[model samples]
Target: MWIGSAAVCLDDKNRILMIQGKDLVEWAVPSGGLQENESLEDCCIREVKEETGYDVQIIKNLFIKEGQAEGGIHYQTHYFEVKLIGGDANINDPDGLNI
Candidate 1:
């Protein structure tokens, strides 16, 4: 099983900050798998910044989803509301796929 976190960042105009995911190429909230020893709050902030180049402050957990895959792999995702702090939107990452 794997645990992941996502950030739902809202802008001043009430627009949600969605990224063009590298793998899925779909517009979705910034999210990623949690790193070892990393807190969920830190994961949310880091994932958002890595994907959208926007630093965020997680406000609260919004929801949790759990499920299983065909290969018996289980997954859990935690979603949180976040506020943008700083950073410029950059959809380019040389070492990995980017939005």
Candidate 2:
């Protein structure tokens, strides 16, 4: 099983932030697998910054999503609502999932 974290960011206009992977045509929340020795909240914050170039702080955890994929790979994801702190909007995904 794999565990991951996702960020739910909102602007002053109440619009939710979303990102598109370089290889994906669909839009999705900024998310990533939790790194070793990292807290779930830290994982969520890191993913948002990496994917969207936005520094954020966790407001609260929203929910958890668990399921199995076609390959029977079980996964658990933690979602959190985060507040924007600082940083310019740009893509800098280390996974090269952004151009």
Candidate 3:
């Protein structure tokens, strides 16, 4: 099982920062799995930064979900509400786009 953290990055305009994965082409919150010894909060912050180029402050844990995908891979996902601290909405990696 893989554990991952996602962010609903809300801005002053009430717009959420969503990302479009190059592979998936679906809009989703910026997210990624935790590294060894990484806290959930840290993972959320790091993932958001890596995917969206935004420094985010986690406000609160919002939801947790688990399910099996088509390929039989199980996923455990954690979602959090976060506020953007700094950084532009630039895509640091070509794998995804900040929308």
> Of the candidates shown, which would achieve the greatest lDDT relative to the real structure?
2
Decoy 2 TM-score against native: 0.93
- Which is the winner by TM-score between candidate 1 and candidate 3? 1
Model 1 weakest lDDT span, ten residues long: 90-99
Residue 40 error, candidate 1, Å: 0.5
* Top candidate when judged by TM-score against the true structure: 2
- In model 1, state the lDDT of residue 26: 65
Tens-digit per-residue lDDT, 1-99, candidate 1: 989999988878999988774578468788889999999989898888778788888889999989997899999989999998888987645337745
Pick out the ten consecutive residues of candidate 2 with the lowest summed lDDT: 90-99
Off by over 4 Å in 2: none
Candidate 3: C-alpha lDDT: 0.84
Candidate 3, 1-99: lDDT as tens digits: 889999987777988888876657678888888789999999999988888788989899999989997888899989999988898876776333433
What tens-digit string does per-residue lDDT give for candidate 2 at 30-52? Answer: 99999999999999999999888
lDDT of each: 0.84, 0.91, 0.84
Predicted candidate 1, C-alpha RMSD: 2.1
TM-score of each: 0.86, 0.93, 0.85
